[model samples]
Target: MKAAQCSDYTSTNTYESVLTVQESVPTPNLEYDTPPAGFKNPMLVRVLSVALAPGDVRVMTGDTRELQGPPSMPYTPGGDVCGVVVEMPKESKKKGGWSFGVGDRIAARFVNKPMGMLGEYALVSPDVCDKVPESISNDAAAALVSSAAVAVIISDYIKEGDRVLIYGAGGGVGSHLCQAVRLKGASYVVGVGKDAKRLKSKPISCDESVNYTKDDAFNNKEWQDKPFDVVVDLVGGIWPKLVDQNQSEKSIVKSANQGGRYLTTTPDSAIFQGRSVWQILRVFLFPALWRATYTRIGFSRSYRPQYSYVIGLPSTSDIVTRTLSLAEEGKLIPCIDDSGPFPFTTEGVRDAFRLQASRHAKGKIIIKVSEK
Candidate 1:
């Protein structure tokens, strides 16, 4: 089978040196590598389309080398896939399962690991795989899995009439987060990002948009009267502290009302893609130091908002299913970047990764894995 394999650690975050097309990459056959002991057994899925996300980019670029370690040489590099079930063993059918079967169009995101979805065949289990609706395009289904799932999680924390602030609101997860929050009945949704035009281009349902490049991104007097009920920090680390690292950036966090929640999808070095070893270490260690510093400095932390990390849900199937249902109902839309879908060829995958690493994609990057 043909697969876009990561030949080695990417020299830079762009994945130019690491990703290459290779034939003869062994395809997964349920006969050899069965699903886990108790995971409803195995189902063989023929890759159709795949989506690019920051997590996939980080893995290829060695940003996660210290934590996830490097994939063995020639490892396939992808996380989200939309595919068709080519083979389903009778034993694979659990008595009270989702009834997944051959020919079912499925969308799944591989759990964080070296496991790849770029290959021709992917071994999927009931836990992470969800049957995508006929109304959803394969490209959209592939793009919806990971980011939409995170958006679902973030929305769960918001309540009706809540004033929500979504940082990085123009990117994949941020775009979905805006829509999800609106669906959750947020009274007002403010999207903050570097590109106001891109934010306005997507139907993200944000009530207002803030361009961080401007002098008063979120600190303007216009925002002073309206405090946020929830702050979703999709862009974390020093980004929140960029305008002013010495003290907490009021624009990023201080706007949150007391007792409100502050959520971040990225909580560690995960967001720092091959930037520098020192930078990665600082991010990994800063959380602890930040907590201690707050206590030692005797800083009045009474008004500190609840800080939490949006670790992906244990079972992504639920969110994936809900996202697809919303898509099928036309209540939600998958935000595929304007750059459009990349071909399934090796050069296509490489180019997609380069665009993703650039951190400026207006929406999800879709890879056309196979034709309908």
Candidate 2:
């Protein structure tokens, strides 16, 4: 089997230096029988397409080592996968009414160690895998596994007829979040990002687009005339500053109506990079503590919107099923970065990671691992 393997973390070097395509890597070995009490056997999957995300970059560059520990050397680097089941354990027939079989197209969040779906074949647990509908393409299915799941989870916060604002609204999760909120009955959606054209385009189709690169990015009169009922911050570092006493009336916080919810996916840092233990703790803990105290004590009512962090919980079968169902229903469309579906190669993978790390990708960065 061929696989793209990372020899070491890219902390001290470029991604090109550490990541390479090896022609002869061993395929994952699977147990035919379930012998363990708590463990379920993993199914072997033939990789079709994989998506790159900020978390993948975090792990590759050793930014998350302190929190997630180190990845073993020469490891594959993708978690969002769309693949076909090539092998299944005998116990699968008797377990949890398993419906997947060999050759069934599946999309999964493959988080097992060392071996990942970047290779020709990888092991996937049925728990995190869901059948990809015939209507969904492999690329879209791969992209949906992670970002759309987060968007689906976040959509639960939206209420009918609410006016919503989203930062980084052109990125993978952001694009999906926009559609999800619309599906949830938000009266209006505003997407903020560097690329206004993409943010205003189809699939995302934000009611209004604000380009943060401009000098008067957040100064739109519409924001003040009709304040947002909910603010989803995919870009971090804005919420803490918004709540500061030194903030002026022109602050982004002022654009949201008092008592509106401010939800964030990245509370600690917007950019993933190597950080010291103290840095990580202070960034996450301080804001979290302040949010809790401020809301509980009623300080948030007068000063700012209610704050809450959006933790990317482990993918569940229900979430995956809902995401696919939404996709099948055309309510949620996976937005692939315009620059990708990069070819499966050494350079292609590196370029995909480069685009993802740039934080400017219009949507999900996908690497086409194999043809369907």
Candidate 3:
């Protein structure tokens, strides 16, 4: 078990390190009793890896510590992982739970501590594990899970002939969201971002692009007349004071707020009152944000599922079969930014984090946690 370990912050130049993994690395046992937690999951590679999430960072926001410690300590940040299931909870035999077993190569999102896809071996609940779609490679599988889901979730309200716009439409999630909108056949797809470097690499159905760096972007001649029907805001910034209620019909804000300073998603209301636009705010933390709240706002007719959980995880079999078929067709293009050989062995993890933190680097970043 050769894994990278982030011992401290000073010596971070070494992005490559070797680790000795025991046959049984200490894993958090989540069984109710000793009913049958499971066996050791292993990686037969001297490795490192992590999924690139520009939004998520390894922070000590609330009672944080190193990955290894009490259950309450910060978990590793292995959000989007594509790895083999070497073992599973014995309780997996229970009826109507996650259908996973040993050796099933799967892709999933995890949050607890911050082992983010860089750990060679990880202990993940089956709920987070979905069988890798036959359509994507292991690396692509690891890269696209979180970003792809972001695309899928935002495109839910789309209609066949609707016009769509994606802000920050060049990053991983914004890029994929644009592609998904194209796949579903939106009438027009517009992409806006800070520059072209990010836009050049993304595979999107963008009919137009607007670079909002010209001092007053919103008041520009191009944007003044070309208002969109649906705007997908992926960057956290000061929202517009008012959006035309009549012109821009709907919107989805998919980025995380940069804390209290940025009054993100606040103007969704004025969309109707000021701009005559029917705005829809779609955040990824949970669907609960949209529900009863939307009903209270009196847009119940626009919301879907009638109740919540309507857009739950799709069938694993379906995701695997369909995505694999799409992959074969070459319809999916995941922009890859970085791949690593890591545990950060003091220097390894910090360097990886530094690269990941850069505002550049389009597509995804991955570390080779296990040999494919």
Candidate 4:
């Protein structure tokens, strides 16, 4: 099985190296074919999976590492998969790591531990699988992981008609949130970040978009005194406070409802490091705190209120699923930064990551795992 192993498994620095497809001893003579239904277990099928940590910046790892591929050492950093199930687990019919027997078209959310999905075929856990909705294309589904899931998680915490402001609103998660907000009936979904071309490529629900490069960006004249109902901040570090003075009750919030985090359920590396212990703790403890705060403000004398909240929780797939349905209905469209000839060859996976590493890339980048 081919996989991208993290060399920095215990290091603060994050670097992954690709080893040769590990050929196991007493290897089962796995045949080459498709799974009976839509899952491929114990069989070889062409697949493409996204490796780990390819972006302008790494979350939790702190500081951005150059997005460069290793020279034939650490392979692909992929663990998330959108691919074909060429075989089914031999253990049981109801409980294979796939939906189909063989030759099935499917998409899966992998538990990044135990294995990865960066090559032709990977041994994986079937319990985490979700049938790719017919409405979702493979590229879109592939793009749906990671950033899309983050957006879905963040948007779930907001109230309908709430004015929302999003930082890091141009990359994958930001783009997904920008689109996902429409389903929530957001009063105003304002998106902020870089990649000017991507910002304009699709008509997102964000009522306005401001480039962080031009002038003070979020602090420009257009937003001198505007207060937000909710703030989903992905752009970290320096922040200049902005709130409506008249409201008196500051409602500027980020996913800080849980200390600037919405991804509490996903056990990514940050969680393992204990670096985000407080962050995750907030996800668990914030809801109660929020309920109390809301009630106190509602009945208190000091509750004049501008608008805003820090929302951070695991969003049910409802929003992403709904958006996908909307796409199917032609009511919404995902900006197609790039689509493909379906499953890519191993070399193609390498090239795709190389392109994805370029800081200018936009939209959901995908390597097809099979013919969809």
**Residue range 1-372, candidate 3, lDDT tens digits:** 333333332223232432222233344333431211122221211122356564333231221222222233222344556777765665444357555556667766544433424455555545544666565677677666656665655566565765666666766666677777777767777767665545644465477666767543344455445544455556643244222322353223211120101112222221111111121223322333543245334433342112122233452334433443444576757656544533434454555456665544455666555556
Clashes of 4: 37
Name the Cα RMSD for model 3.
Answer: 9.4
TM-score ranking, best first: 2, 1, 3, 4
Best of the candidates, TM-score: 2
Model 2 lDDT tens row, 87-182: 886465444666577999999875533137788987777777789999999999988987888899999999898888898898899989999999
Model 1: how far residue 100 lies from native, Å: 1.8
Off by over 4 Å in 2: 32-40, 69-71, 90-95, 112-115, 215-217, 244-246, 250-258, 272-281
lDDT ranking from best candidate downward: 2, 1, 3, 4
How does each model score on lDDT? 0.72, 0.78, 0.47, 0.47
Best by lDDT: 2
Error of 3 at 285 (Å): 11
Per-residue lDDT for 311-350 in model 1, tens only? 6566536778888888888877898887879987878888
Candidate 1: count of backbone clashes, pairs at least 3 residues apart or interchain:
0
Cα deviation at 119, candidate 2, in Å, is 0.3
Regions of model 4 farther than 4 Å from truth: 1-76, 91-101, 112-115, 201-205, 221-224, 238-327, 335-360, 369-372
Answer with 1 or 3, whichever has the higher lDDT.
1
